[model samples]
Target: MTQIDIKVASSEILEKYFIGNELPLEAPVETWINYEREEKGMDVKMKSFCHLLFYSKLGSQLFDSINLDLDGSCCLIGTTILTAVRIAVDPLTEVVYSENPDRNFLKSNNFSYGIVVVGELPYSESVGDSTNLTIAEPGYDTITNVCEYVKCVVIIMSGRPVVIEPYLPKMEALVAAWLPGTEGQGVSDVLFGDYGFTGKLARTWFKTVDQLPMNVGDPHYDPLFPFGYGLTTIPIERKATQ
Candidate 1:
């Protein structure tokens, strides 16, 4: 049987004993052997059995268990459950402002005024490993088309800077949110004005791939966005609801 099948079988066996019972937090190895022999009509001396303790909760909890391997050796293992919480987020409304408003296009066109473009570079497994610095295929093309329709904000999530100079002119704003992982609420907070935008570009954003191996203080050193470049904005206060 596969590992998943084993786990499922183990869980099924354990669930009957776990639910609606005031059993002790830990059970002895002998107890498991007795339970298996009596409940399933098996001879403990002839066959080996596996015992697993399953815990499903939101916070930290300790569990102790012992398994009898095929070689008649005892193995002890501990399992713990970590943090789990749900976050409630409100629906967001999109509003866009242009330098010169187009009334005719706004009435006829169904295109959105505000857009967010997420782009990334080729992923690498190792740190400091060299990979393609250019934003890959479909992402580059998608950003180009979206920017042409309306001024959009582009967010790049990667370990290092990428070549985005071609799409800079059309993009209204650009954010470098390097690998936020599971903390996406933090990004939405800033985008929705709940928080302010006060981040600065740590690395020099090059214009093209030809500028590889470029750094600060190098001769003819020019970049699309220089190091330590950031824009500051004030947080918008949420109005009280009646």
Candidate 2:
């Protein structure tokens, strides 16, 4: 059995073909950049703060590394030019370290289980709301990995709908526990099946970033979960004997 080499960087792969070659005279710089970005799935906007800080940094590095190999005669024109590009190649040992034990436990037990989401979902930290909020990579990894074992009922404790399209099909159930401020007892109660949760989606939950400007009046009206969509728990309404 041959082990596939995952340690190689994209730049390294490209360099093997074009490192010593001169840039094509007739090749359009903007067209090349656009084509590369599309092929690599890196469509980060230059002016966006979150993208500039996170996704763009690595993408810019990859592009710059390739750009340096181009002939000096080739004119590179873009919104931003990367001064320095850093590349590090390392073999991935473990994708999700913390979830390993849990996965093994689930495998050993082979029983139905539920997932209680405790992270702060797409919510504003300060005076204004933010856009294009997706679950972090680690969180996505954990959820998707866990889902592989068996069906899962996810309870998300966020103030708004999160981008769960890619992972949505894996999840059997979803609960949007929007900021139940101060009182966590209710949230706990719902998780333990002590209380029935009935919360509706106030806004649209987008499926992908391409489906942006997702509002009530948008021309492209497609969401993973539409507005006002809510899942109802089993009718187990019970009151304490007072």
Off by over 4 Å in 2: 1-102, 121-132, 191-193, 237-242
**Could you give candidate 1's per-residue lDDT for residues 158-228 as a string of tens digits?**
77887788778878888787876544556666765678898888888888768877888999788888888
The Cα local distance difference test for each model comes to 0.54, 0.48
Q: Clash totals for all models, in order?
A: 0, 0
Query: Cα miss at 209, model 2 (Å)?
Result: 2.5
- Cα distance off (Å), candidate 2, residue 25: 81
Query: Model 1, residue 171: displacement in angstroms?
Result: 0.8
lDDT of 2 by residue, 1-242 (tens): 11112122223333332454422222212222211112245543222111111123333223322221122223232221111101222224222223233566657765455453533544355733656665544667667667778777665656656677777788887767666553344555655446666777778877876787688778879788888887766533554432
**Best TM-score among the predictions, by candidate number:** 1
Scored by Cα lDDT, where does model 1 land? 0.54
Candidate 1 wrongly placed segments (more than 4 Å): 1-109, 125-132, 238-242
